[model samples]
Target: MEAPIKAPTPGAGGCGTVWWQSGTVYQIYPRSFQDSDGDGVGDLRGITARLDYLAWLGVDAVWISPFYRSPMADFGYDVADYCAVDPLFGTLADFDALISEAHRRKLKVILDFVPNHSSIAHPWFTESRASRMSAKRDWYIWRDPGPDGGPPNNWLSNFGGPAWTRDEATGQYYYHAFLPEQPDLNWRNPEVRAAMHDALRFWLARGVDGFRVDVIWHLIKDEGFRDNPQNPDFQPHQAGINRFHQVYSCDRPEVLDIIAGMRAVLRAYGERVLIGEIYLPIERLVTYYGPGLTGADLPFNFQLIQTPWRAEAVAALVAEYEAALPEGGWPNWVLGNHDQPRIAARVGEAQARIAAMLLLTLRGTPTLYYGDEIGLGHVPVPPERAQDPWGRNEPGHGRDPERTPMQWEDAPNAGFTAGTPWLPLTGDANRRNVDELRDDSRSILTLYRRLLSLRRDHSALSVGAWRGLALPSDLAAEVFAYERIADGETLRILLNFSNQGWSVPLDEGGPWQILLSTHSGRAGDRVERQLRLEPDEGVILGPPGR
Candidate 1:
């Protein structure tokens, strides 16, 4: 077994830096994380019951997906009552208890805030659609039909087909970016903005540390309601939304101002963070930082998820992203999320270890998708058990494969639920699970624990300035290397993206120990002038002459 890591002194990075700046955030999909009370679904109490596990795993924060009152059309993404908890996830009291339990464990709670749209069942939408002359009618986007009596323009829903749905009673059509049941909110409406802002305050009042704002870029659309231009290189196999470049539909100029407004609200309350879920390019993504560093505290960076898994490709992506950050901007990394495939599934089991090493050691706050640490692979979702609206509409677009239940042990349902799990467990759970791997010295769980423990112990890995290390041109093809420097302490991270042993000269030539390694057996080994990396291995090395 790996040696236990002692607690590191708090505030080691510095006093002015916020906890999130140097800490790790773990995303918990409540419905898939654990099912407390065994009602066949996960609830707030289920998450509360697992706080000890998260705290033990060394996570600094827990970002739970939406738990608000919803009609479940788009799962919890379509909110009906911003201030109330859904019956499936328990009551408001249950949510409070979760906050209490999480805080007691010193783990910050980050909630998923869906500000872009609301369920058609929402009272506000109900009233707004009651009549064209209704006072709340303008609260949502409702436009008249086109000349041919079809959708206003060529815009399409993320789920598929037209973005507009006609309401026969009013001869007008409402817009929804995703599901028709989820109508787009008129963020252009001042009252809507205020109400949504107040929703943040509602949780802030109840002790939420921050929010992972869902689809923040989709909050504001083009003012003219113009058609999104078609992609010149569109493909038949890609998402339908991709047929258009989203020129007029998303990432509009006004989004920056709206994001800054959210930041202002967070700043009013001390130390709270706002993380926007943006899938734009690096150049445009940085703009979410706002004009004067006043936008999202951490506009979620997901380039790693889309970039090819190769040394040169990843290094280039990292450099491009770092260089693109606006002044005073902070960076964050995400390896996986509810909407994407798991790391292990994407890069194979062996490379997943290297991916973990890179994630925890990289110069940014890292968000760990639930079940990633234990090396959970994607669980196949049979047609009968499929749950994602996107996949149901588009055969290959479903995210159900990645939204499986957490494997806590070798029990039936992987100990996630007593009755039946909302999603099937990856059959490998019996051999690869927290209970089975926590005691195994070379298990992925142990590697993650060690990496997190090392990150906690070293300020360099947490808040240090990252600089890429130069390798001979011919020798740099399959290896990625960088240095993290803090308070004169320098650490080098070397990763071999290929499944072939590679060696790099340790030019500094002094006493150096492998602080941590992707291959567990290789960790803590002493090294010198020549460093050889096992196939698909990654290692963090203390500076020479130390």
Candidate 2:
């Protein structure tokens, strides 16, 4: 069997767990995290200014979204320079300072690595587009027009329309799984692979703990470039790109080799993480861990985000995902991200609390999106203020709603920036800001902070064995229950997925104390045997001795 990644030295009464498994990750969208210079946009230095808040929140690592040099086409996802910081976000010195402060506060730094595509402005793409004879012509995927002067075969961009855009000057069409300005790289080329791997080395040399690779599955494509078949189940409400089944375009087998290559670079720097942004079937997602376990350290399990919020549905998903995890592969969970609707908005305010409990207690590394702790819902973006190209092209499908500025306090602009904020703040700043939640024990922010603290202080919640329990045959159908145990400690987690109250008999142990409850004012209570669950509430219990 392949050896598992080495574990950090264990503490008293704690299991030996890898840093990624034992710690929580907080994702910061750099454009909205904080604005130190009052540029109305967040920067690396602004992130430095906010390190203390993360430290206070008790996350072990911070995964900041792209802050690399880009033209803001897809925000920072379109990189113009692999090794340079964008002037809009600040200089290299600023990033270094952020890293220093994060580390000093015992937090690791994970950068967003967008190797799938680089901005057309990138020197590599610039040279490739310069002339057909340019040495870097093969650096990106370029195809000649077909019989009707159309794109080669058929593939669709995630944003909208055709996957290929014609370069009139060069008489060739370049492929882009996203925006036309973001040209897909030819990972089939060894030079391209080496250079992309070098980008990892560049940041590794600068103390970046790891990378959250964007579109890792889209890095390679089928060699035949066949036209994808139409999806028979495609619905009109879904994104237009879903019209095609993506059979010939993405999630290719060769992509595993590329991810493995990136993994090798990370291995050179001990104990670092490699998080891939893969939205695929559960079985397919785990394959990124590569044969012999040498691929991405975390393939990013997002089932919870995509699965229906019903109890049976979520329970089955959790069980299937756990069963499908490859040996020694670390699991990670993401509730809401910059790409999706906020959890509170997606599952309703009541269920979001239960979702937070599930995310933390589940056996995996939990990724907390910025502002989720404060129950930030989606904020609308007016037509004129809409900056996302996705929303611009697709009309109603913009991500701006979920990418609003962090609401730190009730002051003028929610303390995110001095100037008019980039994206509108979500909810009344006075009612939803972190400053307000700090003193409200019943707030979502309090639940998140308490959950993080619980996970950090107890191995049972963080790096423990998970076992889904079957509910009583006569009990209500809207509850999910599980147990996590480690180092002689155990926690029984129960959640009522519906509005109605529920009840379950205690396990065959003794003297259990209410370690935590989603409903405020119930923790610290003792449960003799029969445990009553509050409406839409979740609870975590531990033996009195534990």
lDDT of 2 by residue, 491-533 (tens): 8888989998887888565468898999999888989777999
Candidate 2 collision pairs: none
* TM-scores for the candidates: 0.97, 0.96
Candidate 2 TM-score versus the reference: 0.96
Every candidate's CA RMSD: 4.1, 3.2
User: Where is model 2 poorest over a 10-residue stretch in terms of lDDT?
Assistant: 1-10
lDDT of each: 0.88, 0.88
Clashes of each: 0, 0
Please list the residue runs of candidate 2 whose C-alpha ends up more than 4 Å from where it truly belongs after superposition: 1-16, 473-476
lDDT of 1 by residue, 1-546 (tens): 111111212343687778989889999998888888887788888898889999989999999999899999888999999999999999999999989989999999999999999999999999999999999999999999999989899899989989999999999999999999999999989999999899889999999999999999998898889999889899999999889888777888888888888888988899998999999899988888888888898999999999999888898888888878776688889999999999999999999998999999888889999999998887888899999999989989999888888889898888889988888888677887789998998889988898899888888899887887767765577898887767768788899989899888787734678888887676567898889988998989985433
The runs of at least 3 residues in candidate 1 whose Cα sits more than 4 Å from the true structure, single-residue gaps closed, are 1-12, 543-546
